[model samples]
Target chain A: MLIETDVLVIGAGPAGSSTAKHAALNGSDVIVIDKKSEIGAPKRCAEGVSKEGLKKLKIEPSNRWVIKELSGVRMIAPDGTSVWLNEEKVKLPEAGYILERKVFDKHMAMDAARAGAKIMVKTLAKGIRREDDHLVTTLETMGEEFEVKAKIVVGADGPESRMGRFLGLKTTLKPKNMESCAQFEMVNVKMEDPDSIEFYFGSVAPGGYAWIFPKGDDIANVGLGILTTETDKSAYDHLLEFVKNNPSTQNAQPVELNVGGDPVGGMLKELVTDNFMLVGDAASQVNPLTGGGIITAMEAGVYAGEVAAAAIKDGDYSAKKLSKYQERCEENIGVKFKRDLKVKDYLQSLSDEELNSIADAFHDIELDTINTAELIKQLIKVSPKALLKLGKLF
Target chain B: MIIMKVNEWCMYCGECAGVCSRSLIEVRENSLKFDKKKCKECTICIQVCPVQALAKEE
Candidate 1:
């Protein structure tokens, strides 16, 4: 089979779907392909997204895909001291939904399809090469080989982006920068507050944190991410230990398992080449501190789609034209990513004692009056050294 | 020569492939492919596996 498109998106995740939708809406012919038989099965996410993030994308919340509407966050220190931040009190935009990604992702693809983008499932790109005025991609689907000639190719292939490497972009993640994650959707779990998500920090996770994002009153996604360089044990080992030790999940039974690697930092310097561009995890657009990328990926997709469509209309597929995508990303998410990476590094450097002290300081504060600025002031007071390390972010 | 092994516990999640310094691994739908000739024996994959499915053997 031979298919020709103005834009070819390699993966149909949130990034690819958004890119296709916007590009197609802008009068570019777009085709999206994914290797998975089902769009969002075997989800690699913890399924948490902030309300502000969805609002930024202009996506209204639907009960069909929202498993739980969370109200706030709780941080647990290494010594088991818990500090709660009520969303109503703190006015935190981070409080939001635990999504059913299996449904949500399919809905995103559906939106793209409705926008005139073609979609192929269980299709994998074998290789790509430069053609006369476009790029040619060899794809395999259902034991059939097909060719796609695209004027612009967008790589939205997630953290392990083979498409990026094949295009001569270095997308390999280092051990220290990558978070090896393992998660289980567990049932029959007990929770102190199902309306609030929980994070456990310190040696238990070592370079990352354990999380419980409640799905319902008796179910939650229990997981943890750890740096491979910081521990000899695999991420699975740490997760098992965490579940066994944590009081809330001790008796919970895992109904599903999800594991993947996240490039927490190290955003690629270049996200485009002649006739090619990268978005989402392929471009390392995730938040370093929180490992959140869904909103950022959608944002990158929007930029890449608009830029690609404009380049198509202008009949210029050179790296110079696609460089506009990079510029937009840098101005938007890139600034925050840089600061987040630094904060992630500083937090990872803290000892368990230091973490406990920081938690203690927050616990001592009046929660009703504390904001992020005030919280940071309290943090600096507790550990004066934090000012020197985190001063640049301010 | 060092070769990487995938045990039965493997989930084909592609974590190993993403971190491979040489990009020597590929995760298909149900199987993992490794290019032993290009491997540098970093063992980073073994450490990153969520299920301890990967190992380095000499």
Candidate 2:
């Protein structure tokens, strides 16, 4: 079959769905393709987002998608020292929700469908090419071969993006710069506080951290992200060990397991080229410091869709025309992501003692007083030269 | 037992190392080293290689 569209979005995750929805709403014929038959099955994600951050994305809080409303976060050091921060009391730092990602992604895709975008599930983008002014995307939908032609193609195919690779774009994250992750959805969990997401740092995760995000009082997502180059053991092994020994989650029953990877190198130097744009984990737009990509993916999708609509209308699919999306992203979100990568690097270098000291710095401070300036003031006042270069994060 | 083989196309991306339950694959600055005892032959590392750098050799 032959299908033609103004914009073709490859991958129907939160990123692709938001792009398709926005492009269609902005007067472009859009089609979204996903390799999965079910839009959001085989769930993966720590599933934590801040209330304020969700509001900034303009997505209404829906009971259908949210598993739990996260009100606070607690970071635990190797020696068991802890620092807690509440989302509601913090002004600058962002925190949001624990979502059922399968449902959240499905709802987003459905909203795109409602906005007049055609969705092709179980369809994979096999190859891509440029013929004259239009781009042709070769596809295989559930064993059937097909093709799509479009003026603009958005690649949202996760960390190992093949669409950009098909174009010979060649951007990649180094093994050391990527986070290999493993997670499990568990029931009968014993969380110290159901409303607070728990983060444990040190060798348990080896250059990363372990997280327990409660879906309910008795169920939670227990996961961890380890630098791909840090250790020879798989992330799943680390997660299994964490579950077997951790004080709060030791006795939980594992109900499901998921493993994945994300690039933590910030945005790819070039996410847009002639007639093509990459969004979400595919573009490496995740927060390197937090290893979070859900919100950033949608943010990049919005930008990609907006640019695609305008570019389609103008009949100019040149790299120069589409570069506006990169500029918009850098100005609004890219700068922070770049900054976060540096913070992650610095945090990785700290020893257990340093980490404990940093956690202790926040011991007496209230969440309301945890803004950057205040934190910086507190750190400098106490340990001034101790953090040195890393202190700049505050 | 499952044994996986690496091809010349290995990107040295450390994916094989990242997925191995044991510390089997060692990613060095310029090459990769595989250990027999550490490898359970599960073949998951082979399946997840993005570049098809790995193959199953029973």
Cα RMSD (angstroms) for every candidate in the order listed: 1.4, 6.6
lDDT of 2 by residue, B6-57 (tens): 7885655455554454545645323566776566666656644534567877
* Cα lDDT of model 1 by residue, A332-378, tens digit: 99988898888888889888999999998777567887667776788
In candidate 2, residue A315 scores what lDDT?
A: 93
What candidate 2 gets wrong by more than 4 Å, as runs, is A91-94, A367-371, A380-387, A391-394, B1-58
Best by DockQ: 1
Task: Please compute the TM-score of chain B alone for each predicted structure, in the order given.
Answer: 0.93, 0.79
- Clashing residue pairs in candidate 1 are none
> What global local distance difference test value does model 1 have?
0.88
Candidate 2 lands at a TM-score of 0.86
Candidate 2 chain A minimal-lDDT segment of 10 residues: A87-96
Candidate 1 lDDT score at position A270: 84
TM-score of 1: 0.97
Residue A41 lDDT, candidate 2, scale 0-100: 75
Q: What is the DockQ of the complex in model 1?
A: 0.79
